[model samples]
Target: MGLRRKLLVSIGLILAILLVLLYLATSVILMSSFSNLEEQLVLQDVNRALRVLETEVLELNRLLRDWAAWDETYAFIETGHPSYVAQNLDDAVFANLRLNLMIFVRYPDQILYSKAFDPQGNRPAEIPRGLYAYLTPESALFNLPHPDSSVAGILPLPEGPLLVAAQPVLTSRYQGPVHGALIFGRFLSAAELARLSQMIHLNIDVRAYDDPSLPSDFQEVRSSLTREKPLVVQTPGANSVAGYALIADLLGRPALITRVVATRDIYYAGQAAQNYIFLSLLAIGLVFGEATLILMDRLVISRLSNLSTSVTRIRTSGDLTERMAESGKDE
Candidate 1:
């Protein structure tokens, strides 16, 4: 009803509105920023997974190059040297080198020698039935545009898929009237995938290009070769997210899909921080509002109240000569 009460109400309303707006703005901005940062962290994990897998491939290439460009391998391919096979292509050698398959092909598709091994079983293994049939003249391996250049890629096998590397057989010096091609392969087995997962502390999933069960994000990644960035998605029914990247074989065909997933620890941490900030701000607003109201009541509202009381008394008593007393130097 009076000036002091009206001023108190108006200031309280303004402070309350400002506090609400500040809280909403801070929450929205912080939540959005934290969401983006979590997405970036998922992306970084995916990139690290890709790098580790690529390093494995490069190592395979190096090993294949060494074996392919060896003098014994060249001599064995040319002359069927028994000693070379006896000394070098044994189970111990395969186990030590960690190779799943080794094939020696004499130029235009004549298989000089082909063998598959299971290092885990410590015994000989069979190549995927009919896989060699695809190595005919029309195949990518036999039809290499540059016969001298080396090739490495994924090959679909009955067991699953294999990472393969091939090189033209030459003397150890890498000189050649290329005699033939030598191939080395390693299967992408469960053990291998587990090893990779442990290394990066993320789950890894691999799918065939045409797998009907492939996730939508993975399919999107496979639809284009130029898509350098992975498709990231939050996992359903889990506190985690995944990023999908398409892997192409040496022939530039989408051969495999890889997904990297990480837990939402960072997201959870950000959320906790945001909640703490909101609560702290609310508490601060309450304290500030109380302090401000008290100061206003003492410094401004109390003085105004005294002036109103004196004016009212003069009005009621009909004393036109009466003067209101000054409260302090503030007047």
Candidate 2:
């Protein structure tokens, strides 16, 4: 190939290789950095949502302590007072407290009173039939040996998931010959979840792990939730990323899955920055390469060609008078 064409091709090839290497390196380092940042932010948002739910459970337990230790509640559990239910278990109280079910039962099994309320409908509802299974002696609710020790945790029943607390009925002053346990339950219904999502200002989704039907994303996340990785992060699409965590029940079984999705603004911004820089460098390289080729042609290549032509003519025609063109500029 001619020198000019060869030079152009060589420079182009070199520039392309350099650009490719830069792109790969930038993607590996820059993209990885952005991905780690996005995962941390997503995890923080979702974990905050989870913390809000946990705080609700803790607050509900505190509320239970208030009622369970009251003088009226101490008498009502033993007497089976119709007056207590009439005076205390109003529909508004259930709706205000967001309570779905409450039961008064003695240790090892006697269920004295049970009430379930539909908060939305403002009416009495049938209690979860599986409620008793969680109240058995095997469970933490009725197995309390100390008045100071109370129970509060999640119960994933057939009807739905419940945030329940069981406290031993005692005097208002905290004195207890420990009568029966007062168990309170609230279903983690859609409305309740919505309220929690709004409170935390984060989009959160919860799915039952053992449910017969779960969303495709939930199933994928569930598989990733190994003992080593309780929290898994993923990019479901080009524009969005998500964080997933398992919610274990009181028995430490995988009961629910919580997911938090976020927009890929950080990643997209990094990619845009990379592209802009690569394009800018490409433009600069092209301009610089053109200038370099022109300089070489003028200062060295053109003069060398002229000198060769003059020498060839001198040798062929026996004319020793011809001279090569020379320039003052440095090659």
Candidate 3:
């Protein structure tokens, strides 16, 4: 082959090797690093969502404390009178607070008064039957020793998961004879979840952890999560990534699953960067290869071609007088 063709082939082979290395470095190292960073950020978002839920529970507990320490509530638990319910425990209170339940119970499983409301319907509703299971004599909701005792956390029920709190009934001054326990509950309904999502600016989904009919995605994540590995992050689609976590109930069992879905902005940005780098390298290689061809032609190939043509002419004519010219270059 001619020198120019040979030079092009050599340069092409070398550049191809370099490009392969570049592809591997970008795909394996650069993108991997960006993927890891995206996962970490998603995990952080999930944690922030969890903290928001915890704040909701804490707020519910504060509301419970306000009622539990009221003198009217302290007397109503003993007297079982309708006057307190008439004056304070109206439908408007539940609607305003968005509360689903209020229960007054004496120690050892004696329920004095209870009411459950449906905020969406703007009416009173029956309390979930499963709630009584937690109110058993051996239950922790009412099993308190001191007047300052209070408890709150998630409560998973067939209707839905609830944010529940309980406190011992006390005088308005926070003084206590510890008569009984006052309980309050609010379901984490769709409206509530949407409000929470707005508050945190993230898409949140919740599933019952122990339910057999959970969606495949939730089941997949649930099976992967353990006490040791409490969180799972995954990419379900090209445009979005999801983070999963387990929420334990007041009984310390995994009762609910929470998933946060976010856009793949970080990963997408990395992909764009990779494309830019590859294209930039390709352009540089082309420029370098062209420059190399020009230098070869100027410094070596053109002079060699001229010498060969002179030698051929002298051989054909049988003339020894002709000379082969050389350039000033070392070649």
Candidate 4:
């Protein structure tokens, strides 16, 4: 090709190569940054869920301890009159607790009586016959996967694994060696789970098991923990993900495996990142485009023009050795 055409092609090639390199480099940097952002978002949600759970668990424990200390409990254990114990467990406490907290009395054979906080007051019920086989004659408190002689065990009901926080009831009024155990029961209800979800901005679920081979109840409490509040279902939605952590309550209930959900329909944050990448590319293109022009003008065009003038002068003087006077420059 001609000299001019060759020069034009060389410059175009150089520009094309520079642009492609920039796109590759920027894409790597942007992708890494996006991954880091996702990790940070997930970490934030997990921390939030943990905080709320800690607070709720603490409060529940406090309430249970308070109930155990009530005078009516002393009266019931002393007199064997459950009626007085039921009377003391009122709506005020249940409403304050936001749910019906039950206390069951376990006998040698089965749960002798289970008392719940009803709307009117305390309601008593007998333990299920199916679960009677799990009771014990022991005087000490025991956890689930109950011994054969174990008395009534506190269980999270409507079916989630039980949180059987049992304490042997002992008072000056009781005759036997620690008259049956006092069992505290609290279910992992939707509201309690929702509170956990809100704290983390993510959906929450829990499963408990002693043997990994056993099946479990996977109850979904909320939608997602992402800032966007995405949907959580059998299958995750677009822009959705899930994470989990295993925890065991203080009562030594079965290991509680907690699932934290993160999801959203729209890639609001990802789209924003992409837009930023595009803008950055545009700015870089402009800068390089301008730089290419300026360099061509100064190094190629201007310098060549000066070289031509020097050649013309030398030709006119007929002196082949006449060196060009260096312009206001060192070279």
Candidate 5:
């Protein structure tokens, strides 16, 4: 091949290899990094949702403790005091407490009082039959022996899931010989879920662990909930990710699943950024390759071509005295 053609081929080959390497590195490393960052962000949002849910449970337990450890409540459980219910369990009381159901169970599983209320309307309602039936001698609330002990959990009632708290009835001082247990429940209604979602800035869903209607991806994530860390999974063909955490009942069985979903805006943004970077690199490579080829033509290939022309002229005209031109520049 002629000198200029050979130099062009050599430069083209090197630039092609470099460009391929650049593309591979960006695709493999940078893309993977962006994916991991997106996953981490989703995980962070899920963790925030988990923390908010935990705080709600804790608040319920604290409210239960306040009501259960009161002197009037202790007396009402034993004497069936009509004045106590008329005074304490009234509409204002339920509204202030934000409780849907209140149950006072005497020792050995006797339900002294059970009432359900609508906190929004501050009106009485029928307690969920499933919840009423679930409170038996074997229930965790009735089995508590210590006045200081309390149980808080999610329970799937016929109406819906409830965040329930139970505490052994005692004096306001948390003092002993517990007569029974006082239970409070807050329904996990649509309003409540919306409030929680707003608080955490993510879409949240609470479902029974064995709920058959859960999406397949959610079920797959839930299956991995045995792990200590929350399970995070990308929803198929969606621009969002989901995270799952198991909420156990008072008896320590997985009762509810908390799912948090967040969009992958950051991932898409990262991909855009990577594309920009790749384009910038490609442009730079093109400029660099062009400059390299121009310099080789001016400093090396041109001189070699001149030498070849001189040799050909000498061979054809039989004049060995012909000399080639030389530039002042060093090779």
Candidate 6:
């Protein structure tokens, strides 16, 4: 090949290899950046969910405290007036108290008098024993033991998965002596949990269990209930970043909240950025390759071609001085 052709071919090959390396490097960088961004977004989402949960727990606590301090509850329980208790368990009180259920677990006696209400203020029959026992005095109202006691933690039921909270019902007759205990609770409904999940844009399954034998709501996923970090599920492929987030809820029940994202979407986003970078590098390489071709054609190839012509002219005419006209100008 002629000198210009040879130089051009060498430059193109080297530039092509460099461009390929650059493309790979760009892809790696883009992948790292996109993965970091995705992780940040997911973390932010998880934080937002935690904040919402905190607020909900605070609000519910406030309402529960207010109900516990009510004088009507004290009088009803203290006087042992089931009739009066029934009357005060009105829809109006339930609405005003912002509680779905009113349960008075008579401590020491182990008798539970509870009333159920809908949002509109209509009182319903007490929930059946199987469901209500663990939630009330009958089951020891497990969570409300004295703060210093070992039994202060809430305990779950055997047959049905339930965590019971027992709060001591103090009597004013002896200037706030612990007369007995009271159980107040509302089941963590699937609908309520689903609402919480939607607020965080997560698909969550919540399970509460006191008994080891009972089937768990967490689909039998053997996980430490105490771990604070999220359990991660990873996606396949080097370019993909799909995963699942497992979050634990410890308030009403020990539950797991899971969030999932697809790897295909992550791969597409990263690939899109990488493709742009490759195109830009390709353009730069093309420009450099073309410029090198032009320089060699002008400075080196033209001179070599003129030298060849001049040698031929000198050889044919047997003249020492002979010149060849230079031809092209690169624009």
lDDT, each prediction: 0.78, 0.84, 0.90, 0.53, 0.80, 0.54
Please give the RMSD to the true structure for each candidate, in Å: 2.9, 2.1, 1.6, 7.7, 2.1, 5.8
Candidate 6 lDDT for residue 51? 60
Q: Name model 6 segments beyond 4 Å from true.
A: 91-100, 116-140, 143-166, 170-175, 197-228, 231-255, 260-268, 320-331
lDDT for each residue of candidate 2 in 1-331, tens digit (9 for 90 to 100): 9988888899889988887888788878888897788888998987887798799889989999999999999898778889999999988899999899898886556888889999977899998987777778767888775789787878788888889998899989988888788989988888888888888777787778887788777877787796577888888888889888888887788888888888999889888888887888788888888898899898878888887888888899886786666667564
Error of 5 at 225 (Å): 2.6
- List the candidates ranked by TM-score, beginning with the highest: 3, 2, 5, 1, 6, 4
Q: Choose 1 or 2, whichever is better by TM-score.
A: 2
lDDT (10s digit) by residue, model 6, range 136-253: 3334353444522111122233322222334455433322444445544444455555777777675443334233443332333335333564544344345443333343333444
Residue-pair clashes per candidate: 0, 0, 0, 12, 0, 3
Prediction 1 global C-alpha lDDT: 0.78
Any idea what lDDT model 6 has? Answer: 0.54
- What are the models' TM-scores? 0.87, 0.92, 0.95, 0.62, 0.91, 0.71
Where does model 1 exceed 4 Å of error?
1-9, 143-147, 215-238
Q: Candidate 1, residues 22-58: lDDT per residue as tens digits?
A: 8788778988888788888877877887787787788
Q: What is the lDDT of candidate 3?
A: 0.90
- Scanning candidate 1 in windows of ten residues, the lowest lDDT window is 224-233
* Predicted structure 6: clash tally: 3
Which predicted model would earn the best TM-score? 3
Model 3 residue 320 distance off true place after TM-score fit, in angstroms: 4.6
lDDT, candidate 3, 169-266, per-residue tens: 99899887787898899999999999999999999888899989998788788889877888999888889999999999998899999999999999
Taking all chains together, the TM-score of candidate 1 against the true structure is 0.87
Which residue segments of model 3 deviate by more than 4 Å?
317-322, 329-331
- Model 5 deviation from native, Cα RMSD in Å: 2.1
Worst 10 residues of 2 by lDDT: 322-331
Model 1 residue pairs with clashes: none
